[model samples]
Target: MSEAHEARISRNEEDIQDIWKVVEDIKKVLAARPPLWCTFLLMALSSGLTGFIVRAFS
Candidate 1:
């Protein structure tokens, strides 16, 4: 194989490894966070606000 072609392939492999390391680090950080029940609270608040706006405009 030509030297330039081999160099290009080596650089590509290094880039893929760097990308995987970044993904693994993000996964670890997300796994360490505690789960919360905030979605339901937000949904209820949004629904109430929509109803209020509709009633005020009617």
Candidate 2:
């Protein structure tokens, strides 16, 4: 193959590898985060508890 064609193929391979690395990093971040339901549950529980305390003080 011509040198130019070979160079293009090499660049394409490097770009593809970079894309895959980004996808993997994103997956790791998502896995580490808490699920939406868990976060919502915590917020609801805290709000309810605070409301209860305020009501008692009144």
Q: Which candidate leads in TM-score?
A: 2
1-58 per-residue lDDT for model 1 (tens digits): 9999999999999999999999998777666753433555578899999999999999
User: Candidate 1, residue 43: CA error in Å?
Assistant: 10
- Every model: Cα RMSD to truth: 7.6, 11.1
Against the unseen true structure, what C-alpha lDDT does each candidate score? 0.85, 0.90
**Candidate with maximal lDDT:** 2
lDDT score at residue 45, model 1, on the 0-100 scale: 93
Cα lDDT of model 2 by residue, 1-58, tens digit: 9999999999999999999999999778767875965687789999999999999998
In terms of lDDT, model 2 sits at 0.90
lDDT of 2 at 56: 98
